[model samples]
Target: MKKTKILFYDMKDYDIEFFTKYGKNYNFEMKFLKVKLSEETAYLSRGFDVVSAFTNDDINKNTIDILAKNNIKLLAMRCAGFNNVSLKDIKNRFQVVRVPAYSPYSIAEYTVAMILAVNRKVHKAYIRTREGNFSINGLMGFDLYNKTVGIIGAGKIAQILIKILKGFGTNIIAYDPYPNYEIAKELGFEFVDLDTIYEKSDIISLNCPLTKDTKYMINRTSINKMKDGVILVNTGRGMLIDSVDLVEGLKDKKIGAAALDVYEEEEEYFFEDKSSQVIQDDILGRLLSFHNVLITSHQAFFTKEAVEAITVTTLENIKDFIENKPLKNIVPQDNN
Candidate 1:
């Protein structure tokens, strides 16, 4: 009997470490490729039974056609979000499975860290203290107690973040298309309309997934409704907020501070060392120039636990496919 062959794209050291350690138990032949899955790189899947992609891989129509032609049965995504993949293209071509919720706590905790760092200027303080300047001259920050926090999505991560915020005695308001009333009641948070979330909320956090309706949700029109000097935090998809509009908001003093773990055009820069090169993207350069803006290279969900969970879940998804087990995490044709 031939063993299942899996081609892992966008391979990194950590991914290799965890997957290789656990993959031995599954008795599968796994190959790692540093190149991302794209139209050009999709041809390499010819002899593989499964193509394992990461968050940044290009999984559009062109790539899917190649993978399908190569007889790839499964597209296993190691990350939670599949926004990079075109679901319609893969509808009848091949089955897709993803690690949907691998350590929500990692994301939730990182979000809290970004929020606190930006609001209290903790990042700046560390730098100032290191420079031997202990003056609290420009370190004024508002208290989190009694602050109104608006969450865009009420998923597991958002709920966990809300619980943490509640410890600071915050008024939590969330907006989700499919709101869980029971969870809202239990979490002591209210589900409100987007308009209400904008009108109120001293601190606005975008935890929503990127969809047709959610892309650029924080444009100039919505930014106009937010409270002046509002702190914005986004650990979700980068496309959820309009980068250009955010710059304008910062310039006009509408947004006080911003903490971003993802950017709309992060594929070229994130997960790689670009310290030696000049940032070519103008908008990203502008964002970095802001004193109140804090940008991280999409490492919110990069905890040790999350990595192990992702590896185990991805391998299990493949195992299920090979054994003809039901794929519970399969990406449906019309999934939104």
Candidate 2:
């Protein structure tokens, strides 16, 4: 009885700690690689039963072809969003599984943190106080009580955020293709159209997944509709907002403040220390130059609880694939 072997790319220290702990009980042989999965790294998958990767990994058609050629049977994604993967190109070569829900509270709470930090300038205050400057001038902030907050995508995490915002006495408006009318009625939040959400929200938060319908959802036309001096936050996928358009909105004073935990081209910079190098992305550099803009690395899902849940679920995906169990989280490559 040979144990299943898995080659995990983009392996970080936390991944090592948690996976090693849970995976030992599964009797699986794990080969962890620090480099992110890509066409160039596909050859490394040879002889492995499956390839496990993170959000930044490029699991495109070419890489899939190579992995299929190397006898890899499954693509196990540790993160929820699989937009980086070319699912259409999968073409039934192998099954894809992901950890769809992992400590939604971590992300929901982080979203609230960004909202408070951006609106109240709490992060700036901490810095100013540390520098011995306690002046309140230029530190004027808005109150969240009775503020209009618009949320996109009412998923598990968004639901948690709604509950949190309700405590603040906010007027919550959400937009999701399949609106949960029951939840909306119960939570006392209203479901509205995209135009309404954009036109009315004082603080807008993007909590949606990235899809063909949602990529660059916040662009020039949509930004023009938003209230002037609106505070924006995105803990969702980065490609959901157009970087250039967002920068322009900030420059033209259409958006008052932005707190972003994700950026469109974050793969090159996030999750790694780049203190020795100057940022090469002009858009990212411009974003960092603003005092009103707060940018955090893609760390919303980086809580201790989230990491353990992700590791456990990802390993379970691997085990289920190897054992030929029904994959509830399998991402279907084709609906046709």
Candidate 3:
């Protein structure tokens, strides 16, 4: 009756605190590492039974091969996204499971917060009032009522967001590869195409997963199709919108404002504090220079409830693997 050993990569303060508290309930020995799971760090899993990764960890083919060589049996992603992993490479090497729906409400609520904060210029207003300069100059904001909101990807999070927006009296249009007309009817929204989403939506939110076809989906061509002064919000994967193209859109006033929770190249900077170091990413630097842009570290799904659920579900996934139970959260290959 030996306890299973789990090696967690990219460990944060909250992760350590919560996982340790939860680990007590299960007969599991856990080791937390600050370094991300990459090809270079995969060897560290040689003596461990399982490897746990976060959203930003590099789980490419090389890393997968190393993990396989190290005798790691399971690769558990603590987050919902598997875009960082090389799924095809992991097919025969080891099994992979993820917390697919830890807390859809967490992300959906955060998305609304971003939309409201940017549209109302609350960030600017806070700074201005703090300086004792509350003249209300250039602090105008429009009402969310009667606005046309187009949502990309009609997943659970997107559906929740649509329900929240419906309360605001805004018209909602959605675009999804697998459109559910029943859900659309139930939610009081219409499923439209990407072109219609671009042309009709006064505000657009990206809630889709990253895929081969979706990489840099919001490029110059897509931006050109969007309505002028459209408010863009991305709580989904960062690579969904090209930062370079977004900067250009902001410059040309094609995009009125943008709120981003993720970045394409965020592994080196997102979770860690770089306040003392200068930003080396030119696009990120340029993006920060804009007054209308709102950028946050990837924390949309970092709620107390969400983290707790993630911890419980992840442990259950491991427990199932050890007991030879069918994994409910197993990631399928080539959904890209």
Candidate 4:
């Protein structure tokens, strides 16, 4: 039997190794492409059975159309989020699959790490110690115990975070349109309204997916409702919070601190080394200048378990598509 021809695009060295090892077990002829999947790069997958993509790749309508034209049937995404892909355009043209729940624990743990680092000012302390300044002034941090924490989304990642925060004895209040009452009851979390969460929570964490309804969900209006000196953490989508509003809030001292693993306009420069070069994005540059803010290079999902799970699940999706079997993680056009 002929081995299945697979073109994996925008994959790193480790990712390529993982796929190469796993694909050999299933007799898949895997071709790794360093270039991203776009209209211009779609021709690279000609005569291939499937095209694998990563989060940063451009899987827009034109790209999907090109892939369909080139006889690429399967679009396999190694990441959970599919907001970058055009669902409407690829509905009938090609089948889509994604690794939806790779490792919620990785993201949850990273979120907590950000929260702790910001509150304790660990980043600043490290810098100060390196500079031979032993002064501990203005490094006061409150205990997590008995503090009110507001979680915007109550999905798998949020649930894991809630369990961890509960270990710290923090008061949990969550705002989700479809609340998980069972989990709330088991974990002693309160399902409150969005405004109540804004007014009451000492720390606010965003763990929701980005959609048309959730775009700029945390804007100037919502920022005004937040408690003064609130700590904000976002390990979710970057567009969930408005950059302009967040800068204004930081300027006005409305937000005491922020720990962001994602940014609204991070696509242009994230996951690459631009440190030696001049910073171009004004909002991002200003965000970096603030002493109270902590930013990471979208590495919340970078973990051994997460990476293995993503690789295994991605390959399994391709195998299922080729065998005409049921796809567990098939991404439909309307998952509303």
Q: Candidate 1: list runs displaced more than 4 Å.
A: 334-336
Roughly what TM-score does model 4 have, to 2 decimal places? 0.96
lDDT of 3 by residue, 56-175 (tens): 999998999999998899999999889889887876668899998889999999999999999999999999989998888777878999999999999999999999999999999999
Highest-scoring model, lDDT: 1
Residue 296 of model 1 has an lDDT of 97
What TM value does model 2 have?
A: 0.97
As a whole number from 0 to 100, the lDDT of residue 275 in candidate 2 is: 95
Candidate 2, position 215, lDDT:
96
* Cα lDDT of model 4 by residue, 29-115, tens digit: 888988888888998888998999988888887898889988988899989889999888876778899999989999999999999
How much is 315 displaced in model 2, in angstroms? Answer: 1.2
Report the C-alpha lDDT of model 2 over 227-307, residue by residue, as the tens digit.
999999999999999999999999999999999999999999999999999999999999999989999999999899999
In model 2, residue pairs whose N, Cα or C atoms come closer than 3 Å (at least 3 residues apart or on different chains), thus clashing, are none
Using lDDT as the measure, name the better of candidate 2 and candidate 4. 2
Model 2 residue 54 CA deviation in Å: 0.6
Candidate 2 stretches greater than 4 Å from native: none
